[model samples]
Target: MLKAQQSTEMERLLMAWILLQNFDVQVSRFVDLISFLMADCRYQQMMKWIGNIHETLSQLFIDASPLDHTTCRMAL
Candidate 1:
């Protein structure tokens, strides 16, 4: 009976160790996925900001063109 109890305990300990290893791997993968997602999110935000700046600059140039043409005409 004592040997049986020891065997059972050993099995339980082995199972616990396997579970802990698997849990560690799962946690590591989860952290890597989160880091990749965060980097991708930051990249998306930066692209969006760059797009907004480009649009603003384009609009400014569009708005200034007529004024530039009128000034050139007046000067001539």
Candidate 2:
């Protein structure tokens, strides 16, 4: 499923990093996913993608944004 994201290209990876930031969830699950992806042999080909994921996570922690963000709303 993730194979199609096969690119270290910075521009695309940057966009992906931003999206990941806005949607980050459980820390363990997120880290586990990135760790698994990093261990793959094909990973070197997509280093930027994986690296940006890590970078986004790092920035999230460093930014010190307050929790309790805008409340969720459901209407469907």
Candidate 3:
């Protein structure tokens, strides 16, 4: 999206909120997939890719909550 145009503040915020709302189930499924793939020949490389995805998701949560810092500070 950034390549075409920057998101409006509201759009970005909404994106983050949506991402967070679904993240619990999303990450759980990702973990299961990763575990299932662990015996593959590419296991080590797959772990690194999954780790990067996780970091990106974490950043999304951060980006979403900065405007209302207190909201993000609460335990998820």
Candidate 4:
């Protein structure tokens, strides 16, 4: 039989950071929060968190770059 998997603290933190944006979190705070998540020893969760961060930043840049958000204030 297969056992159910549980989330580690790092994964939980990453999930929380992802959800925080829905609650109107500041972008800089969200980036800072990722640093806390990266401290965990769980390799898989850490990689997932890295991917999530990369994806989010990539999309934000994609939107901001075309909109002339060089100051980044309007995009965020």
The segments of candidate 1 whose C-alpha lies over 4 angstroms from its true place after superposition are 1-42, 66-76
lDDT of 2 by residue, 35-56 (tens): 6556652546576668666666
At residue 12, candidate 2 shows an lDDT of 51
TM-score of each: 0.31, 0.43, 0.33, 0.42
For model 3, where is the 10-residue window of minimal lDDT? Answer: 34-43
Q: List residue ranges in candidate 2 displaced over 4 A.
A: 1-24, 41-43, 65-76
**What global local distance difference test value does model 1 have?**
0.43
> 1-76, model 4: which lDDT tens digit per residue?
1222234564666575565545345555555556555554357866686667656664675566443545344444
In model 4, the worst 10-residue window by lDDT is 1-10
Give the Cα lDDT of each candidate.
0.43, 0.51, 0.47, 0.55
Candidate 3 clashes between residue pairs 3 or more apart in a chain or in different chains: none
Where in model 4 is the C-alpha error above 4 Å? Answer: 1-11, 14-23, 51-55, 58-76
Top TM-score hit: 2
Over the stretch 1-76, how does candidate 1's per-residue lDDT look in tens digits? 9778667545644543453344333433433433433344334764465455335434543554533544322332
Highest lDDT model number: 4
Which of 1 and 2 is ahead in lDDT?
2
**Residue 37, model 2: Cα distance from true site in angstroms:** 0.6
Q: Tens digits of per-residue lDDT for model 3 on 1-76?
A: 7433333433543544465565444544544443443333233664576556556545555566435534434544
Candidate 1, residue 4: lDDT: 80
Model 4 steric clash pairs? none
